[model samples]
Target: MNRTTRHLGHRARPVLGRSGVALCRIGWLALALAVPSARADDWLTGAPLARQLASPVDVAWSGSPLRPSLERLARAQRVAILLDRRVDPDRPIELRLLDAPLADVFEELAAREGLGVTLCDGVVYVGPPETARKLRTLSALKTEEARGLPAAVSRKALARAAMRWEDFATP
Candidate 1:
């Protein structure tokens, strides 16, 4: 049996199944409507999106539908994850971790579903890998363009601007 769910550094595709989760119109208000028994995880790292990617999260799930699991994770982390129409919200994802960084989880999701996650402004932008790659390329181009400014600016300012856009570029 070939499993699609990726865990930690390993990667795999889901064996056989299809599902979709709609994140649209599902904000915190909607999350409150989820199953009463669902509990939220704590946000251990008090860092920005870039650093928060390495935040530790304890997850234990088995054959859980992609949508609800993700919704729970998002709520726990106090982050909003918006799903693109191209994603299958109902897809099955399995995860077991005593303490794994958020990036590892995101990578697992990508390995299983060919999805790309961009963290910014307390929101996660998820979509096809190709789309994500293109966004990153565009962001890098923007950074390069800034380097070509007619007037030479301080290294600090240029670095800050590049860092700002780099977050959006990476998954």
Candidate 2:
């Protein structure tokens, strides 16, 4: 049986062989991917984007360039946005979204620019449509993961405006 040593962080770990090393790498990749997406969603528990979108907003763009429009939206929504360099930032974009949900505005932008938008790490991304779709998928997965939240603690002091024992004291 072949064996190898891998120096990870402060300690060295052992591997059985080349295949073991590869398997270890794959396991690490999967775990690394999961941790970030899962933790990145802590901020999402409040549904920040939904809350932002739920509130009506007015937008009027008179053939303005894409960058500025995105910047404006980012400022208004207080969300960081990573723009794609490939997209013509100066390309003229026109839209009139009156008191519309934030998501609709993004969808309209995506349609006009032939681009896509995604939410990751509390940031919005505007770029290739495929990338946007992937981001949406990741977001959906994170939401699904959140659905099966850990069981509630056995005992806790709870208070609420509409407090009922049935609400908090359910097993």
Candidate 3:
């Protein structure tokens, strides 16, 4: 019995052979491995910056200057952080913690320095208490104002206007 076929002057052999079965098994295995499996901490996946801030960290500083310590933390956590000019960056700080959430550490520092900490548009802002209080409210208002625009324009405007220190400052 002849089982081969010809197309465009080329012979095509049957593919369901030993090698084909092995290929199929390999494909199934690959697919099974590629699917995302459920995790216990799946709830932590929301809001990337929030997730990063929620990460447990160990920090030990003895009279370290504020600006450099914040820069180091930002680098280590791969997150954006801003220190408002109104806040004294050169202020000496003492922080010692083991396996603490990064947000808690920021709160502690803010309290100790008589400043404020707020997360706006993915960047952590450390500044005057009044500015921090108003940042989120202003961001919400701007967002609501952009809601009527077309999706692309809205996205562009939002990205361009990512919460800046100038937005909170009144001249």
How many clashes show up per model? 10, 0, 0
* Clash list (residue pairs), candidate 3: none
lDDT of 2 by residue, 15-65 (tens): 122332222222223221222222222223135655774567788998898
Error of 3 at 21 (Å): 57
The better candidate by lDDT, 1 or 2, is 2
Runs in model 2 with CA error above 4 Å? 1-46, 136-171
**Model 3 lDDT per residue over 14-119, tens place:** 3222332232222222221222231112212236656667678998978888877876776667655567767777788998989987777787787778887765
Stretches of candidate 1 exceeding 4 Å from the true structure: 1-47, 120-122, 139-171
Q: List CA RMSD, all candidates.
A: 12.3, 18.4, 24.3
In TM-score terms, candidate 2 sits at 0.52
| Count of clashes in candidate 2 | 0
**TM-score of model 3 vs. true structure:** 0.63
Query: How does residue 56 of candidate 3 score in lDDT?
Result: 83
How far off is residue 103 in model 2, in Å?
1.1
Angstrom error of the Cα, residue 154, model 1: value is 21
TM-score-based ranking: 3, 2, 1
